[model samples]
Target: MTDPIPEGAQEIIHDTWEDGAKRSAFYTLDGQQVGYRSWTAEGQIDMEYGIQDGVQHGVFRTWHENGQLCELSSL
Candidate 1:
């Protein structure tokens, strides 16, 4: 199978739908999105995704809604 979808983007089925939510994962820009997300019963995002660069080639950080550090990852 193809490599897993990148970290930031997801695809959704758009048949008769205005939003693409049912589609599976997708690529975000050219890179993978760097975090996981928590959702509510209604499918709203609750927590941010946690992600780190697969390599130590860049700098990055993830934060909570209150601006607290959730994770510090580098690529």
Candidate 2:
């Protein structure tokens, strides 16, 4: 699997989405998004996915609000 956090990534911005989920978005120094990890409103991890060359790539995962893993997939 491709590593989401690449050496080129130099920023991590934490923000809340319109859907109310909080996320930490990884970006390169020039502002290319590399990957993100998201959490539900109650703070449980909701999903994690990677990006490559501006497209979704690598392993993708999701979890239930109760903390159990809901899915594990690859792209």
Candidate 3:
């Protein structure tokens, strides 16, 4: 199963490498990362990875801009 989104987390969005692509990082209120999601400059999802209790966990995946799965792994 997919990891559940952390409750009460704060979200921060940033541009990657000064490119138009966006990355969203999620953190607990106290400031520990919970997960991240990144998108291409054109807004296509590029990757998603989960973290829990300060450790990587659950499903991690990456996709090509054309929407083809590029990688998939379990933490």
For model 2, residues 1-75, the per-residue Cα lDDT tens digits are 554456666657579767755555555646677777777767777887777788887888888888997988888
TM-score of 3: 0.64
For 1-75, candidate 1 gives per-residue lDDT tens digits of: 222234335533222223534322222434555333343334443333233464222334445555565665444
Return the lDDT, model 2, position 6. 65
Candidate 2 structure, TM-score to reference = 0.66
The superposed Cα distance between candidate 3 and the true structure at residue 25, in angstroms, equals: 3.0
Using TM-score as the yardstick, the better of models 2 and 3 is 2
The TM-score leader among the candidates is 2
| Local distance difference test values of all predictions, in order | 0.38, 0.72, 0.71
Supply every candidate's count of residue pairs whose N, Cα or C atoms clash at under 3 angstroms.
16, 0, 0
lDDT of 3 by residue, 1-75 (tens): 464346676767745645645655554556777777777767787887777787777788889879998988887
Best by lDDT: 2
Any runs in candidate 2 off by more than 4 Å, and if so which? 1-11, 17-21, 27-31
Q: Poorest 10 consecutive residues of model 1 by lDDT?
A: 20-29
**Candidate 3 segments whose C-alpha is farther than 4 A from its true place:** 1-10, 16-21, 27-32
